[model samples]
Target: MVKKLISVGSILIPTVLTILIVNFLFDIVPLNIQGLPLVLPFVICPIGAVLGLIGYKMNRDNLARAGMIFNIVLFLFPIAFNIIGTLSGGV
Candidate 1:
């Protein structure tokens, strides 16, 4: 049960971060939080990914796998975006 919760949290944290980032980018709300984009990808996502990996190793199941996948994607997302942006002259 605890392991499953960790997996679920790993998946959820990134999803929420993505939503917050998108909202901030589009100016959908008055998000005055500073350094959120950098913090989410660098600090939060890596932690989530590590937790997910541990959960997956402990459980060896599909939910854990999904959590691992989500965390990895989220963690890599900013780096990938930066590379593409530089290549496309957006950076």
Candidate 2:
């Protein structure tokens, strides 16, 4: 049961991070909103990565791999955006 919960978290964390990052990128959520976008991607990404690794080690193949991939993309997305934004002169 614990392992199952961890597996679920491995997927959920990155999924949520992706949603948050997208919202941040597009300003879909109003900045007037308080505390919603305060989440730290650095913290969440590592947690997702660790959980995904655990899930994989525990043989939860699909969920684990999906979580790992999502975590990677989530971690990279912001850096990529920053690079693009810089190249585009803060687009």
Candidate 3:
């Protein structure tokens, strides 16, 4: 269980957090910081894809399981974010 958790975290944590970090650090829409805006959403896809390939090569079983976990996260996070945004009047 622990290894599975760790494996998922190894890939998902970095991929998702880096997406958020780049957005926030670059001061994307609604952010108060001064910097370049993300004119395109998929601009960061290469980074995530490279990391995903690395994760895939690390261990097939681990990567597969981690991917399932990440998909669940991918499904849930947006709903949660939407709810929060709606409540906060940002929607």
Q: In terms of lDDT, which candidate is strongest?
A: 1
What does candidate 3's lDDT look like per residue over 1-91, in tens digits? Answer: 5544445554664466546546765556465643322222234333444444455566556574555455444445545655887899864
Residue ranges of candidate 3 with Cα displaced over 4 Å: 1-60
RMSD of 3: 8.0
C-alpha-based local distance difference test score of model 1: 0.79
* Candidate 3, residue 45: lDDT: 36
Worst 10 residues of 1 by lDDT: 34-43
RMSD of each: 2.0, 2.8, 8.0
lDDT of 2 by residue, 35-63 (tens): 34434566788889889899889976888
Instruction: Give each model's whole-structure lDDT.
Output: 0.79, 0.76, 0.50
Q: 14-53 in candidate 1: lDDT tens per residue?
A: 8888888787668788768855774677778878878788
Stretch of 10 with least lDDT, candidate 2 = 32-41
Candidate scoring better on TM-score of 1 and 3: 1
